[model samples]
Target chain A: MGTRAAGQVGRSGPVAWMALPALVFFLVFGVVPLFGVLVLSFTQWDGIGAINPAGLSNWRSVLSDPGLPHALWVTFEIMILSWLVQTPLSLLLGVFLAGRQRYRAFLAVLYFVPLLLSSAAIAITYKALLDPNFGLGAGLNIGFLTQDWLGKDNLALGVVIFVVSWQFIPFHSLIYQGGVRQIPTTMYEAASIDGAGRLRQFFSITVPQLKYTIITSSTLMVVGSLTFFDLIFVLTAGGPGDATRVLALDMYKRGFQANLMGPASVIAVLLVLIGLALALILRRLGGSTTASQQEGA
Target chain B: MAVATSAQATSRREAPGTSYGRKLLRLNWLGGTAGWLWLVIVIVPIYWIVITSFKDQSAFFAQNPFALPAEPTLANYQLVIESDFPRYFLNSVIITAGTIIPAVAIAFMAAYAIIRGAGSKFLAGVNGLFLMGLAIPLQATIIPVYLLIIKMHLYDSLLAIILPSIAFSIPLSVLVLTNFIRDVPKELFESMRVDGATEWGMLRSLALPLTRPALVTVSIYNGLGVWNGFLLPLILTQSPDKRPLPLALWTFQGQYSVNVPAVLASVVLTTLPIVVLYAIGRRQLLSGLTAGFSR
Candidate 1:
């Protein structure tokens, strides 16, 4: 028995040894850099010259900064608007296509086009489309819709949110469609035999089965929208009086544009904390739902 | 299941104008019509961009964007090509390919290790460590990364872009690959070990071949992410010669503000490769993303 146990240990030894390089890389590059950023958040540094030792000053400044509050509000606004618009639209589209296999393939391709294009390219195309004069925005006589899509305080953030939603709706649709496809046909047949309407069956069967996918997709959306920077950066550079400046954009401006490494690190650390909080919330929600599902089973 | 299949078969074999048949046909028609409408709506903006790229300067300015260009000309394409666009394309290709190969290979090894030792605490810690990459927003670290690049004398070089791209890709690649490897049955690995297969032999001969689908998905994901990346290239490479296509498009926008046709032409050229790639891998890519939902 001792020999057998020893053999088992020996068999597993090589596997653990093989994981060493990956562990070392993760430690030095991933964990250390993150810890470095957290440490730097407490110090004052201009990204050059000697780093002045400051204690909690950078964090205090970030907490009190007006831009932080404004950026947080815009971030949440964009996240909420994106989720609200994209989720329902994607579900409708997913359901619409679920019954038909032939043309669904074609429609899926079409919907995924925007996702293939680079954010820079998309921003440029939309910029041209939204050009206030002598562009698609003007030609369509929807100048109101086009009016400073990138430059206006009221419309810039909304436009960014719309663009993000448009790009990701297909992604959400794909998830929803996958979930919808997994529902056993017998349930639908039973519902129809009972004279239930399509909407009624949908609410009773479709949405409940899709709970996990919904949670997963929404988690992704929240994290993605919160950390969104590339599209907004290219589209407006957080213009029109910082109206569209989400937290990521604000962090970029602080660190890269303004070269305030210290405060930028603070914002970054905060963003990480926000992501962690959301993830924790999601875990709790996911765990309870899964437990309840198992209990029901 | 057999009864349902036979029922479906009988319905398929039924006459065209019967109640059930007509209902099915009508459902098909409704689905088809909505699908076509969605296709049209989604394709219009892309159509607009492509059409605008072909228009001459005057036609570009005078005509409606939704309408086709009158007297299509290749002058805009020619003009962009004659400029520094070629150099930017080369830079983009080099950086993307350079980053993807090493990142995928390293990630593959890491994923294999983690998968083979399912509940090992050290591997779990390593996995968690990689997840930290997801949280470190690029905006926060751009400053330090920039300083680090400059201090290392790698600024404005292809290395700057490649390093950060590869670094960021590790987490996602590791995530996807770990999931993929986890799905590989442990029996295969155990049999290989029983046969006295070396670790390298098992990875090269067994695991790598079985993970082809996952590899393809990961490659497409990595390719898209790297190819479309703009921020690192923007800050790291100031030399126009070193800039990639996205930055090149930005340059085109700035340089030829009045030459709108030329600007649109550059955008078309920049987006074409990725569009073609997506068209090829659309099914696999969508499946991969949805696969994440299942996990």
Candidate 2:
């Protein structure tokens, strides 16, 4: 028995080593930097000079700053608003594309083009397209088609949300389509026998069946909206007057652009905390997302 | 709104296949309207982009933004090509390939280990760590990553971008790849073990081939992310020559802010490679993505 047990251990030993390369890479870069961000938050560094220990001063200033709250509010607003706009649209489109018709399939192909373009490319396209003087409206002679879309506070926020939806709705729709297809047709058939109308069937059968998918897609959307740096940076640079400044962008401006690495690290830590809290809350709302998704599959 | 076709009508009459009967009742007018409406919303920008890219600078101003170019010109493309565009393209290619190959390779190995050695406590813990790693917002770690890169003297190098990208790709790749590896039947492994094939041998021969579709799926998914990655390249590399396509496009736009057609041409040029790859792998990429996420 002892010999056989030793033999088993010997066999499994090599298998364990197989996981080492990825684990080491993740630890050095991923895990270590996670702690590194926290450590840097406590010290002062100008991003190009030697770091100096500053204790809790960085935290105190960041915590008291009005800009922090405004940035947080903007982040939450974008998060909630984008969620509001994207969820139903994606769900509807997902169900629409779930059909195997050639036309629907063709539509699916075009719908995803926005997903393939880099965020920078998308932002640049929209910036030019929304130029009030020379943009689409002027060229097409349509009133209300053009505005200083990225110039004002309210309109800039609205354009950011619109652009976010324009890019991601298709990807989320694809997720929902996959989720919708996994529902057993027998359930729909049973509902039909009871004379459930299409809307009734949708609410009762389709929505209920797609619970996990909704959570997965929602989590992706909400967490994703937190990190809207590249797009906003390219589109408005958090302008016309810091109207579209998000948490991630705030961190970038504080650290890199403003040369205040310490305060930027503080914001980075805040982002990490908020991200964790949200992911945990979402997971609690619907069991383990990955586990439920795997079971559904 | 329900644009019923002969195919749909025929499918409705035929015996209800897995999805056919559902489709008949699921004919949603609202959904159809929204889908077609969204199609127009999606296509108009793309059409404008392509058509505008072919127009000359003066023509861009004089003509309808939506019009197909009357006297199409290659000047924009030529100008973009002259502005170190190929260098940036090559840089993007190198960073993407450098990151994806090793990232996918190591992630696959890690996934294989986790699945095969499931009962082992260490492997289970490692898997759990990766799952937790998924929740960590990678962008938040940029400051520290920048510091580390500087410390390691890798700042302003493509390797600086590639290294962190690989780290970030690990968590999801391991998760997706593990799920794929788990779906392989135990009996197959048992049979291989009985044949005296070592774990390494089985991994190379059995697990590798069986997970080929999944490998492709994970590759395309990661490749797209890294190819279109803006943050890493933006933060890590400083030199103009070192810039990836996305970063290059940004600088190009900055320099040619007035040259609208030239900027649009640069956008088209950067996206053209991915479009070609998509056309070739559309089926695998689409189905693979649906399965990857849904699964």
Candidate 3:
């Protein structure tokens, strides 16, 4: 294609030839590997063994597996929980900090510190913080709040959700701040002169104004929550009888731990499809609103 | 008598403060109080981690978890330094630097071409390729990546980790750099062209110099991502000697289940570099994020 395209340009040009490296890169690393993953999904091959074609047996087994459904449920539950908790809080914080106040910079830095730390670090820190004994929760007379967070079946996923939301809120706050900064200050001034209170101005001006950012941030949060693994893997390893076993972790266990590569591929494909579907829905909704918002502005 | 009563009643009806002033004062107080409370809540965990790292095992296990160490000792730091942490840190630095330099360089050139090149079709197709890389999550490609690493006899080596990190980061770097390059004045490139500068020369002399800020921002983004990565390193490196900081910290956790202080100490050590970087680059980081969103 590169050669053909270069020829079609009908100019003896070195500039067109410069694009070959990028083309090769996209082909080898991007396109070929994707095709390989798709094809390998249908075959039964251990990490070492020869590929034995199984003709969709892996897909069938993945569909029939009870564990996959449970994992999906856990994933969706955590995704929704994190979205519900983080979105509104981050928005409020962003709006509050976006104003010309002395402490706005200080507050932004304070909130963003968690996002810089490694997920493993955050997980380990929280595990210690929530320790049933010999930790803050114990020393502060809040032992009831700790409750064997990682060890208990009922509280395990909730603990993971809380930790995830804590790490991610700063990121969403930054996103919302960007959106809020784009909003013209004159709009707020006009509302104030019309005798509107702060709450009325916020609902009528801010929320309706930041619909695009809200959509983008929520989509990112949902996809991130659904496909999350590192922190959970490090903290609990999906233990305490699979209480916090999300679909991503389950897929990792099946593929890498148990060497069920075929079934793991199926789960991965499904996860991708779900993520794409969510992104599409968000873009469609935001598309209509963004047009109107632009026109209104 | 009636005139005296009217004057007294008129004076009594006036209160000390006006309604508008009182309400403004209350609103200011409420906003200030909420802002300070949020600051405390946000900083507490970080303070906990840092303070815990300086305490000895006994201090950590004592009754007061939140209290400052009575005799703040460097014992945990000594332990971390004496252990394999130095090697793990070196590996992490190598992998991160290796990935960032090449990824940023390649992305810069590709972005320049897409911005400067004539055909919209070609540019759009290239952009779509990078976007595809972003949408495909790592879980989907982990198996294939593992197999490819083994086939190339690169398992248990730093290259295995570095290659994948660079590959994954390219999409984002391209996205960011393209946006920045598009913002570059077109006359700069056109003038360089009229000066008889080749494409390579123009890239070196014009575009790269102009996009340094964006390059630094992208490098920081990629650096943090690679330094903190867990899955790729976990799968690629089996030898304890080759594992990076995150995986090394995981090993420490596994081996020292009873030694909470030591594990926390290692966590602190693992997170220090990034924490320091964030502290220095907080403003740039926020601006970069805003720039990314605007694009």
Candidate 4:
């Protein structure tokens, strides 16, 4: 593209300095801190105190700590459970919304309300609503609704997953909705003419065609779940015996709350690695041979 | 001629008012059930939040949790307002605007440069860096960001939050804006160049207007993010005067732990600005978000 311009216009195009401000800002704050997190992991700083070299001590302590594995498992559990709960519902809702119905549009507006609220606000709202004794269930005298939703281990984890899904499903569905609309109507017409029922067409056409979108949404869900700090911090504070302590929350607790910046940086590094790995895995899933075969078909 | 005719036939067959539109709208009981069922799940909590905000503290404990407040009062809202709510709201407004204006301006410039200077190795490398920046969960770098802010004498100030936010907002803003700018016809830029327009001139006149929707999308998206941001404020600032709405909401919840009505009222108060923004920009925000991600 630039060759065409250079040949005709007899000069170079836009100056590179136009991009310098943004590049410098990102490098200083984004790229530098990324490496800084790594560097800080090897040093001892009490978040506000004089820095001192700790070498591999931080790594040894964090690695040997059983809490590290438990936090990893908790993070993985929430990521997987939220993905499982959100994907199918988002796909179906996205397809239903692709139809140009006024009511569906209205429904979408209401559906997106959750996306507007801060995770802090949402967590707080649920905290009040889930109080076992004075909460909605207890007030209504409903036996099942009055359980200690955030007081027990399994139930606390379940409540976190449910709240996370409730907060995010609308956004993913919007992505899937956009994906659904982009699918050509001609394909659906052809399938209808072949006498395929709606369900068969959905399975054969809709699901297969949404392969990339599924990957995109899932990647966002999985990677984004790693940073579910504010919500869990407010909701559980990693309580009920540290049942809901994910890595990001773990980092916060270790660094800010406990003033263990060195060990916290180690956890932060692990989070970055895991997020990158999961994203790459999902991208590979999206670009697999089966997807290519479907495209060819 | 045959290819053109077949294309026309396909277009006619699939045009609106045809069976094609009706066929696609064929009822799916499962989707409908799921949609309506999910609507209930989404709406109930919100409904409860609004109605519960109106009840007085005593009435809250006495009434059914989901019932209408028999003696609704403004005391909750009153209590929330008298407790530094206005200062937090102002801080949020400043931080959001402060982060967004500079972030979007620089991002637009970068996006313009990257698109217009399409073959420049430096610009391409810069673009690639921004793209990779997308994959990084920048939140993980908060410890260092805190250090950077402290060393810069910025800790415990609104600027502490604003600077890093502008940096974080750049990657997505640049990506989305470049995608939009890349769609501008090259012939348009060429014609502008023929008229002796400089790159700056072309950016202001051609790319800027053409990409206004993208700019709005980026600004609103990043704005909402900075508005609702908790981790930065929680980590960076310690003063009560520096608290943003999310962190303010957190502390307020703690202080008023048993005063459910007051806490709920604060939640409603903090969220009202965004809900109003949503009501106004519903179409642009929704459509822009869909296009931005799916593209």
RMSD of 3: 6.9
Which regions in candidate 4 have their CA more than 4 angstroms from the true location? A2-14, A288-297, B1-27
What TM-score, computed on C-alpha atoms, does each candidate reach? 0.89, 0.94, 0.90, 0.93
Instruction: Calculate DockQ per candidate and list them.
Output: 0.32, 0.42, 0.27, 0.43
What is the Å distance of residue A258 in model 4 from its true position? 1.4
Q: Candidate order by DockQ, highest to lowest?
A: 4, 2, 1, 3
Alpha-carbon runs more than 4 Å astray in model 2: A1-7, A288-297, B1-27
Candidate 3: docking tier: acceptable
User: What lDDT does candidate 3 reach at residue A50?
Assistant: 94
- Residue B144 in candidate 3 has what lDDT? 78
TM-score of predicted model 1? Answer: 0.89
Report backbone clashes per prediction. Answer: 0, 0, 0, 0
Residue pairs clashing, model 3 = none
lDDT for B223 (candidate 1):
86
| Model 3 C-alpha lDDT per residue in residues B1-295, reported as the tens digit of each score | 6456445544543542354345445655654565566677678888887888888877777747678889998887888778889999999999999988888887787787776664656766876678656655655577778888898899999999988777788877887887877777877766776677877898788888888878888888889889999888988889988989988888887787567778888988888888898878767878887667532
| lDDT: the better of candidates 1 and 4 | 4
